[model samples]
Target: MKNILLFIALTLSVHTPLKGFELQHIVEPSASMISLQTQNLCHSLYEQKGHLVCLPWSNPIVDTGKISLLAIAKTNEKGLGIYQRARDKDLNQSFLEEVFRNENFQDISGFAEARALYKNTVFSIIPLHFAAGFKLNNPSLPEVHFIEQRQTQIKLSTTWFLDNPLTEEWMSYFIAPSIYHFDRASSSGDYDVLDSATTPYKDLVQNRSLKGANADLALGWSSKILWLPSVTVHGYRLFKESSDCSTCLPTYISLDSLNAPKADASVSWTIDHSFGSSVFGAVIQGKRLFKSIDQDQSAFAYIYKISRLQSYASLSQNQRSFGFLFDANLYQLGIQYSNEIQATALQPKRINQSYAYTALVL
Candidate 1:
């Protein structure tokens, strides 16, 4: 009887505890790549009104305006995984706000996300998960500008395990589908300064009161065919008809609706190898955006139409990880490139972006 009990205990200990508790933190900062003239234009617009009327010309300027910090904690015990993440963004100090502030910007914008997953549930047929997240932004501009965003998502995923006949090694295929609801609201401010000619500005602000549904599909395959490589593909689409724009600004000629169906697809390939206590890996990815049905040439669709390619390599020593990444167009590698703009020279001459990140995992 004692021997039997000892055998059962050893089996349980070997099968459980796949992933231990982990805590991580990340910081990302972006700077505007636009020219000085574009910065001046954004500043002038903000000065004319209480807030910037629209998304920036290059959009990269807007992207550069914010700094983000994130903290995450996760644990997987007995096949039940739980994770929580919190992110904070310095919206006022961002390149966007710096152009207007002329000094350091200082408003806090951030979000919190939590997710729960039950693996091998339902007779080991699928994994069930749910996630919830929210973000808020409070700008320091006059008249009080505030924005709040919320999302809820549910997913069902499954994996198929196989054995390679030639290598006699294990392989896996994974697939997941998710549905989510996203909503955002922007508090109405004193728009008295914006006149008829600046009607687009009003529309931009009021359009923040949007609600819609979206769906995501993801699939992945892993094998040791070529040095233990894996490939993953993900796609998402938004339902335009379900989007509500009732709170948008009123216009006599009925401006083109900015709420349009949008979709994006991306694929990534990665390979990893380990030597002693150190590991090395490389990843390549490509993303493409589909043109929206709303042919309003004045909208942001033009910017979203550009595709991007990304490549990165990483080295990790136990709990420490570091990586360098580059993103750009595959065809244009030089400095005189110009494919991101619609009409003006607002886009940067070179579309390349370089970034690096380091993480300490505990």
Candidate 2:
């Protein structure tokens, strides 16, 4: 009778309307139990489930302009380990930089993140992130260039889960909305040439205030034969004041107004098998920028379009609490490949640059 009642309560919670103050505490424990079961299947699965539950609260859409700190090290061809490089150039050339030269890549970077979860009438979570780094290099110029970077972000979200009769799986759905502020400042010193001529350096400074609205749907099957899939759609808009650039040249050309909205979509799939402990799995995910317009008069408008596709794959082993992932570019039909450098002064070519990341659950 308790199980039946629990099931009935779960069904009602899934269909409940979203209200500013509508808190439902009755279904919290059952959702937590399901989360625990998913965790037992594998650490990656656990992390994925946790992310799905917190997606709405964490604000995945806002561009905090944060880059991965661990990416400073370059992965070898074998994808085994990382080696020390002269400077972390890739860190400075992120997609975010397309909007502004806000970050300075450093040989050593630091980042810290914290999260909190609560259960009441609804599931709520908060996540905080901070990062700092620096970069110094001589790009065949007479003077040395120095860059320092810092970023911080915080988000609040609420989510709900239910059983799907058609797929015979648990469906986790969420609506996440968030706001964030980010800033990047760069400075360089003048250099003296052999003939005692001085070359001037210009400092670039920029900051943006942005808001995002996102929704996600995730399906977790009870049977091993089924695959887990999740889809997310997000939209972002910049504040009017944040669009003004005082020093550095605009990173991207805008059409009509800089406040135009940007749309993004992501899809992910995972499959679990018997291996380490009770859980092991592989995941493939892809993300694309669906909507954004550039002014034809802008120098980059001809070469750089807002359309982009990035895909990733990973293998998980829960017993060791360690996993690795690979990131690459995917070619799309009807999409023209342009020189990224000519379009955005970023990359020389649209090469399928590949990188690997290691996941360690602490």
Candidate 3:
């Protein structure tokens, strides 16, 4: 997770014309694992055996989760060091799986050398909530309403399409108006102790991203179907680090019609040489999504997160264990964790890796 602050540039809400007091918002949630395993952790996360998620698989420490899938990594690289030529225009399934999951699979000569080149490692997402009245001029709707209540009915206008052609350049903006959260798990199964409500803190986050989109068909949610063949962007911002303080601008493309519905799920993924982009990143991002039971809003879910490390350069570069990450909450609480792996080289070079964090959003 990098500098995710200041992306809120309020350009005066241009009301489209509304009649009802209905609201609309969007949300996206994402989670993944990045590592340098040499086919070690790979087989463990992918392989399914005897009704148990075992070898060839990386199972969640906790068996139960609301999320649909869990990604795991191996070489953090694309194209085989064991196969194919240097051309990365077309990577295979193995490559896509490894980088997407991004679980630590490889061990270097020492920590000192590993930390020197590593740049980023993190698992996160960005959520947006728009409390606006849609259908501009609706007879039953209010001119303006709290979008907070519209999250539950949020839905996509169409099944997202791919093959639309991807993009390259990322936008230029500071912290964007968004929601974010994450958890760092110890060897233990517990994810966090925070309440999902308290986890994101508020509408802003630090060194986070608003969205990240990828076009590698192999990693697609409807991998065989939807193809949003365009360059996706992941941006974020921190509105408040203090309990109650002044906010700042957020990062984004500033597209007037780019906003979407509040999504209960935020899909994310990546592709190696197969999906060419000297730098590849994307997010199935949305603005917000809340839940309710018996007409009573039970919970509102949103998150904002960003992370860029210098590891796996061209598929293999400076690797660092120091990064940011989070997970889905359970029972009554949420979870969070951060990592910082550094290197100090003397005649006796040493790699100082420190992993410390707290659990709970209360």
Candidate 4:
């Protein structure tokens, strides 16, 4: 009896720990990759109107007074994984340190945009605007084996405004068609025969190469309410086939079918003062107005701008972030801190993230 009890105790100890590691491998790399990719792609941009708008739908003509050329880079504390240094001063030793780092997961992304507005337009009394940009997202787990993920997006868009774009009360509309491609490879390492032969553990390896194209549109209107504070409303939508939308934005992940078009709306109140500008707003969208698959469908923001400086802070069901930007005519610098929930093997964990960016404005 004593020998049998000892054998059982040893078996439990070995198998339990191994099982935990196996479970972690199952949801790792890919799960972390998806979380980072979605956040990077959906990050919003700051607008003069004091509203937070997604990068793809931003109206460059209004955001920047004239022809604009901008380059921006973002990264976390782990190091630069997306935008590498132009020239490495310590190439040999630094390269070795990067490979052996015990980074469980990391996200790196960046983008560049160029835009111009043409006056005396044939389309409308306002101006015809054109913008083009590209984005790249890379997330990885350095210590994990056989793990790789990358995504690239290209955007080309045009815009038309009405009722004098510069006026206090105005409206604008824009359309953008974008294309993106993503590649991912991940595995759970060599599985033990006991686990591999199990019913649900047979398929623990995945290699996917996918591409998608989507057409997006947005309509925005702002007016003085009772000649007091100004109010702005915006509606945005995306059109795509169901299969192609397997990896759509977080807002659309909960849709039963992508064939049914869905749109999101946001409303904000702006107060213009001698000091600067202030805005408060909330976004609403989808069948699940409160929560979505990975995050809350609704979001809120408060922004204040004075002179060439702006401060932004936001809140949602599961995330909070704060950031500030300084505009020095031809140059801009910004940094943001984010706190959000991230999925893990056993449970959910809260992640504290930081982002720093710089841009040159032409």
| lDDT winner, 1 or 2 | 2
- Tens-place lDDT digits, model 4, residues 146-229: 223333434444544445656644433333332222222122222333444563543533333345544445445443442332
Model 3 TM-score (2 dp): 0.19
lDDT by residue for model 1 (1-362), tens:
47954753453334222121111111101011111111111100110012112111111112112222212111122112111111234333454343333311111121222223233211111111111111112234322222222222222222333444654452355454545544444332224233334666655344344455555454544443334434334343434444355544442111111122222221222222241111122211111223321111111110101123122122111111112212232111211111111111111121211212211111
* Candidate 2 accuracy as TM-score: 0.37
Query: What local lDDT score does residue 123 receive in model 4, on the 0 to 100 scale?
Result: 13
For 272-296, candidate 2 gives per-residue lDDT tens digits of 3242212222221111122222111
Q: Identify the leading candidate in terms of lDDT.
A: 4
- lDDT of candidate 3 over 284-303, digit per residue (tens): 22232211111111111112
Ranking by TM-score: 4, 2, 1, 3
Minimum summed lDDT over a 10-residue window in model 4 is located at 21-30
Model 1 residue-pair collision total: 3
Q: Is candidate 2 or candidate 3 better by TM-score?
A: 2
TM-score of each: 0.35, 0.37, 0.19, 0.52
- Give lDDT: candidate 2, residue 149: 30
lDDT of candidate 1 vs native?
0.25
